[model samples]
Structure formats: C-alpha cells, structure tokens
Target: MSGLSAALLELRRTLDQEMFPLKVGDTASDRHALKELAGQLDDYLLPRLAALDAPLLAVVGGSTGAGKSTLVNSLVGAEVTEAGVLRPTTLAPTLVVHPADAGWFSGTRVLPGLPRSTGGGRAEAGTLRLVTAETVPSGLALLDAPDIDSVVKANRDLAAQLLAAADLWLFCTTAARYADDVPWGFLRRARDRSTALAVILQRVPAEASGPVGRDLRRLLEENGLGPVPLFEIPELRLPENGALLPETAAGPVRRWLEELSADARTRAAVVHRTLAGSIDSLDARVRGLADSVERQRLGARELADLAESAYTAGLTAFDDGMRDGSLLRSEVLARWQDFVGTGDLMRGLESRVGRLRDRVVAAFTGRPLAERELTAAMANGVEALIGAVADGAAERTVDAWLATPAGRALLEDEDVAQAGRLGRASPRLQAGAERAVREWQGFVLDLVRREGASRRGAARAASFGVNGLGLLLMVGVFASTGGLSGLEIGIAGGTGVVGQKLLEAVFGDQAVRRLTGEARSDLAERVRVLLAQDRGRFTVLLSPTLEADPGRLRAVAGTIRAHRGELSGGGAK
Candidate 1:
C-alpha cells in the first residue's frame, strides 16, 4: 500500500480501538481534534481503497451510455454483462464473481449500516450492491457501478458504494461528457486517499480530438488530478460506418482495458506511494503546533525571573541609602574634639576626656536620672536614634531604632532626623548602646582630669588644702608664740593670714569652672568621635546614655540587628 493508504488504515484501526487513552472530557481540545481526524479518515478511506492500493477493487464508474457494461464484458471476454440499447438496463446489482473468488463478499454485513445482497439478479444489477469478482484472481476485485449523475437516487447510491469498495478507480468518462459536474465532484471528494486514478476519455470526435484532449488534460491537472493515467478511445460509431455491432477486442476501447491490466504490480506500487504523502502532511502540521507550545513555555520562564528580581532589588537600594546617610562626617570629629585635645588628636582626645570623670560623678550626684524615667526616655530615645541613623536616607524605611531611652531622647533632641516617625524607637533595640556611651565618656573624662592634674604638677584639692591648713597653722603658732622669738613674729607680720583669705576668695569658683568645663567638653567630644568612628548609627540608636538610663539602649541594639537582617534577606524564613 502507498504511505497514505497505510496511514489511513492504521489511523482507522486506532480509532476503532483507542477510545481515548487519557479519558479526557469530550470538550477537551485533544478529544475534539481526534474526532475531526476520525471524520477525515472516514471520508478518505473509500477513494483510497477503490484506487489501486489493492488488486481486489477496480471500480468501473461512468455516465449513461458510456459502454460501461460493454467494457465489463470485454474484461470478462464474454457477454456476461448485458450491453447495447438497454438504457438503464442495470436496475439490480449483478455479481459475476468467478466461483472460487466469491468468498470475499460473505462478510458484507460487517461493512456496518450497508445493505447486503445474497445472490443478485438483473433488476438488482446496478442497485447499491457489493459482490466479489470471480476473475479477481487473488488480491483483486471489481465493482461495476451505476451512473452517478442519473436521476435515480439508488443509482447514485449504488455508484457511491462501488466507488467506496473498488481498489482501483477506473473513472470511465466518455469524451462527450468528461467535464460533467457530478462525477468529477465525487472524484475530488475522495482525492486525498484514492490512488492511481485512470481517467478513460472515451469516444472522442475525430475533428475536435486535439483541442478536446488538451482541454481535458488541463482540467484534470488544475484539479490536482494531473498524474492520473489517461487513456483515449476514439469514437467507433460503427452504425455511422454502416456496420453491425463490433466484435470483441475489435475496438480501441478493449485495447485501453488491456493496457490498464497489463502491469498490476506497478499500479499497486503507485497507489501506496500516493498514500504515503498523506501521512507526511499530517505529521508536519502536528509538529508545528508543538513548536508553538514550546515558545509559550519560554515566555513564562522569563516572566518569573522578572518578578523575583523586582521584589528582591529593594534591599540593595536600602543598603546603599543607609551607607550614604551614616554619621561618620567631620561634625562627629567636632563633637568628639576634646578627646584628641592636647596631644596627637586621637590620643590626646582619649587623655583629656579622662580628667572630666570626677565632675561627672558630682554633676549627677544628688539627683540621678531615675531608672523609670530613663526607661521612658530611652523608649523615646531609641526611636530618635534609629530615626537619626536613617536620617537623610533617600528611600528611608527603617522605622525606629527601638532603643527606648536613647531613641526617645535623640528624637526629642538630635540635630538630624530619620527612620521612626512611626512612633518612638523601642528601648529594646539598643541592647547596650546607652551605658556603653556613658562609661566610655566617663573613662575619657577621668583620663583628661588625671592628665590635667599631672600638668598642674599636683592635685588641685591637695594644693587648696595644703595652703589653707598651713595658713591656719601659721596663725595659731604666731598667736600661741605671742611672746616667742622675734624672728617668727616678724615673719607672721610680713605675710599674715589676711593675704591667704584674699587669695582664696578671688580664685575659688572661676578656677573650678574653667578646669571642669575643659574636662567635661574634652570627654564629651572624645566620646562623640569614638561613637561615630566605631558605631555612629549605633550610638544614635542608644542616645541620652551619658545623662540617663543607659540600659534600655542595650535592649534595642539586638532588634536592629535582627530586623535589618530579615529586611535585607539575610535571615531564613
């Protein structure tokens, strides 16, 4: 069989068996698609089977008076099929199968929905009927059908069935009516599957033969029937020749039949080749759909990537903003200037701030910044802290520093602003930033004070006490030695206790203020610079530490770390 024939046969077989492997709904596209395929298969099979795919069927179809019965008689080499002047002689289908070849028609009932004929008669001759030809040899059959264009529906139906069954369709068209609409219409309908079509252009006129034959060939080619074998049987018109009916094999018609039957193998091969093309066409269409589906999948993947990137890119922007707004500027150096005061800047800053430690102890001595008050303050400070930390950010998102005391204080007090306008920074966020800043500043103050004392060559307290005590002691001695030696009395008279009182009254508060201010400022500046360098934003989150409850800031620092990480995508789900 040709590829097309094989494909159709296989497709029909599968349709007959595989209802639906996936059991998908009837509405599914695949299901609908398969149904369409089945419909196409049903339409294609008949013409294909009738074409020369198998030797069993060679449908002899033609119009009225085309000498169809005569051709059959010629093939049988007998008068078994009635011929001549018997217009519409085949009212009933006729079976002229050779005795041994009759078995192929026994299961005609399996054709499903088609009428069956047991042994037929002449009235039933060309009726819608099927019968195997006795001379079919092996792998061969012939169906002599009624006129397709006849007024009789039975004749048309009979012609249709015969067309459906024939393995080779010998489309017998007389030269006078080859262009008739009805017969060619049937041929076109089955063209997809049918193969090796033989168009017998019979009974042509002598004078008009050339133009007529050329027109027929052109018509056939235009209708996709170009390669169909063509045979010419010029008009006998024996009556016009003043002769009786012609004898067997005595005309061009017989020679055409002989030519067709001469090489059965080549005809079958041609039929199979035609069928193959059909299968290839279907495969190409299916693969085109597959490629289109693949393109859709690629588009989906690209969309997924874009969504993830857009969402994740926020963290990167936030980090860049925080880095820019950080408190590491020169102003930080000024706040911490005293820390580097009298020597190498950073070292001197450390030393001068240390001396301010004692004044720090005295300043907060009587009234400490209460824990409860400081806690509340810290809550506010933490808010201020992170708020300040994130201050000046372009796309600032961090809410509060969460270091309550420092955040609260910083918010109420810091020069800059930031993160939490949400409310206040939580005191918990600082963890330990408050006390850290204070102790840090206190240590520097102590160092500064010690350095100042050393510079003065003695402790200020010791000098004051020594001078006062010595003056009192001298006065007591002078008075007690009222009648003592003249030298001691003269020394007391020259310097006297009054001079010491004048000196003490003149220098007291000023000297202390001047010295303490230097120490305090020195320590404050140093602490500021250190905080900026080591943990500027951090210190902001733990502010007011030097004055009040520093513990709250200690709590908030941890929250800052956790939230920043989670927000940054560093933390796990």
Candidate 2:
C-alpha cells in the first residue's frame, strides 16, 4: 500500500512540474483534463488508499432536477440533504453519514480541498456540509452532489469533482431525463473508468416503467455498462411533508444500500474495484497530458525555426552588400575623386619621391575639403548599409513568423509586433556601431604615428600624417580585391595605392603593407561584431517560444510503467 501511494505521489509531483498554458492551439481540453486528474489524485485516490477502511461514499449525481437530492434524502429516511423546487436546490454538497462515521469525514481525510462544516450555520457555499442521520448505516455514507448540468458554473464543476472522489456513484435520473444527452455523458465516463455504479430511475410513471427500464438497460449495455444494477422508483403520491412515499417505494435501492453497508467484505471490494480502476486509468490520461506538452514544444520550435531562417538570410544579404562594391557609388565616388585627383598623385609619386612630404603638406594644408568629405562619405555609406540590413532582417523575420500559428498568436499582441521592427538599429546598437568605427579609425592613426616616429621632429608627419593616412586606410578597406580588371578596381585600388606609396615614402614598403593589413583587419572585425549584435534583436523576439526539454515527460511515463503491477492490482499492495 505504501509503495502504491508513493508511486501515485510521484505521478502527481511529475504533473505539477509541467506548465500547460493555452498559448498553443488545441491545448485547452488537455489543460482542463490535466487539472482534473491532479485534483482526483490529491482529493480521492491517495487519501482513500491511505485509509482503505474508511466509510464508503456513494455520490448521488445526475442532470438538473433529476431527483438527485430527493433520492439522497429518502435513502437516509430523513431530510438530511435539502430538496426543494428551487432551480439548483443543492448549491453546496451535503454528505449524509451515520453518527458513528462522523469523525471519518470531519477531518482532512477525504475531499480535503473542500473545507468541512456542519449544517445550519454560516458556511460558504463551497463548503462540504456534513449531516448525521441515525437511519443511515454506519459503514457507509451518501453525498448529495450538485446537479451535473447545473446552470451555475461553480455547481456544475463541483458536481464533477465530487463524482470523481466517490467510491460508488448512485447515479439518479428520471424516466423523462435518463435519455438526455448530458446525463449519458457522465454515465459514459463512469463506464470508461469502470467505476462501481447503480442507476436509480426515479419519477417513472407506473404504466411506462417496464418499457423505460428496458430501453435504459439497452442504452447502458450498448455503452459498455451491461451488468450495472438498475433500480426503479415509480411515480407515487408523496407524503404531506414532500418526502418519498414510504420505505416500500424506495425498496430496492434501500435494500442495496443496507446490504452494502452491512457486509464489510463487500464494501472493501467496491473500494478496491474503483480505486484500482482509477489507478489503471492514470497511464493513458498522463500520456495524453504529456503529448499535449510535446505539442506545445513543437509549436515553439516551429516559431523559432522561422526566426532563425529569416535572420540568417539577412546576415547573408549584409555580407553581400559589403563585398559587391555597392558602397563606392554616389557621393562617396565624388569625394574619392576630389581627394586624389583621378589617381594623378599615384602617377607622379615615383618622379617626385624626395620632395613628397613638402608637396603633401602644402596640398593638405591649403585644401582639406576633399579629406573631410571623404571621411564623412565613408561613415555615411557604412551607416546606410547597416541600417538597410537591419530593416530587411526585421521585415523578413516578422513575415515568416506571421505565417505560422504560434507566430500569429504572438503577433496578436501589438506590442510584440511593434518590438520586432528592426529597420534601424536601436539606440544601443547605433551607439555601439559608431563607437567601433571610431575606435578602428584611432587604431589607424596610431599606426601612422608609430611609423613616423623615426622622424620625430618632422612637421608634416606630426600635423597631417595621422588624419590623412587613416582616411586612405579606410578607402583601402572598402576595396574588394586587387585582381579585378574592371574600372571599379582601378578607381578603388588607385586611391588605396596612392595612400600606400605616401606612407611608404615616409616609412618603407614592408611597414606600409603591414600597417594597412593590420588596420583593415581591425575595421572588418569591428563591422562583423556590430552586425552580430544587431542579429540579437531577432533572437530576443523568438526566445519566448523556444522548445523545452522533453526528458521530464519521458521520465514520468517510465516511472508509471515501472510500478504498473501494484497500481493495476496485478499484485497486492
């Protein structure tokens, strides 16, 4: 018994660890079932197993106005439970126990989730009101549950909970209401659970009782409930007090209860049958819930995959834009032309090699317009490229996500959709990109100063060398490769070579190549870092729907299978 209890406890613990929010489609039913299963385990199964000798509780439940409360009152031979013509006569559940069995229910031994109270006091409507009747047998108790199809939502829910906690269900319904769809639904569930149940066909006309009883039996047999007991209470004149006609009118049901309560072994068999059946049903129900969790995980992964593919395309597009010489056009082209005069400086550098510094300083000092414009054009080109890539990536990610079910759910929240627009870098991204560029430019300036350190006192190297050489290094980094025979290569490479020679005249060939290589590598690294940071915007948006680990669900299934014998009664506990 302890081992079975521990296994059931472990199952409840495993279920509690799951979060089955209805964010995923097709999950609401599974979520509701999961909650109900957990409640049954806590309120009934484990508690009942711990105290197998506890009194048997037979909950009388059925469709609205099906004479459930009336049947309960007559079974105990007293008005222990309220019965009247009000729409929902019993708003709260009333448990009718014998005087000797009062202590069993008053404590937190069963249905502990509901607070226990005595009758005729100011108890909340949700409380379980206990009523002791001497006519009721000591070894058994009867609970008058709310109408299964009550108009009030709370009453309807409470009815299902009470039924799930019952050792046996004395399902009561009228001749007129037995064939109703609602009552049959509960009957079908009871059949599936293999619960101990007996139908009480109440308020039947004497002339129609034979036909109605046969028809009800056929329906029960067809629905996998062939051998379940069926007793009839025909229409008869009630006493002035509105109680049942007499003990003879309630003959069969009263006799069954008396026999069930009198025989201790019979009562234990009923409890064992219901308890074992409920435990056996857990594997399928728990598997259903675990499958629902897996579906949620799959939905999340689908959304994440969409985001990943879209952003990866964006990254590819950005890399292509940088390598295809697209940034060398428009204002940037005009600035480079103005700075070096269509490659004239490279053509004359070898002829005027000795006087290079004097001419370079004079040209730079007299007109710094080309140099300033070139630096501005480079910054503008890089910024525009980055912004366009960011926007394209954001748009693609949003579109892909919108096409999916999970994505549509997320987009329903206007704020999440608004946050997904990545057309421009955020303030933080823009600041970081700009700072990286500025730092790379500083690295170039340092290289120039270091190369010119041999000629420390030279005025040209100190004044314009750092700024002029750094701008040339920026232009060189924009050139794709030195092997192209096209006009773009000449225009871009010509500007780069002019910078190379001027620096070589001041330093030497080896230092010039090494310095430019180092500076260009530094700039490339900075741009890559900035773009990677911008990619994080898409990742952040997709984080909520990421797939969770499925190992916990597998572990739960494994544990249930390991203890199947004890739970299913193949071996005694």
Write down the worst ten-residue block by lDDT for model 2.
541-550
Clashes of 1: 87
lDDT tens per residue, model 2, 451-520: 7776643465666657786775566556554334455565555545555666666666777678767876
- For model 1, what is the alpha-carbon lDDT of residue 410? 36
Top candidate (lDDT): 2
- Estimate every model's Cα lDDT from 0 to 1: 0.43, 0.74
Q: Give per-residue CA lDDT, model 1, range 1-573, as digits (tens).
A: 433344345545444432222211221454444444444445334344433233344667878777666666555555555555656645554444545545544444212334456533444443334444444344444556677776687777666655654446778777788888887787784475444467777677888789888999998888888887777666775543113335432345445444544567655454454443333334433333233323323332332233223222332332232223222223322222222122233332233333433222232223233322322332333223333432322122122322233233434444545444423223432444455434533443354345435544345434433323222222222222233344433323222223233223333444433433453344334323332332334333333222221122222222323332321232212
Output the number of the TM-score-best candidate.
Answer: 2
Quote the positional error of residue 205 for candidate 1 in Å. 3.0
Model 2, position 179, has a per-residue lDDT of 90
Worst 10 residues of 1 by lDDT: 471-480
lDDT of 1 at 56: 40
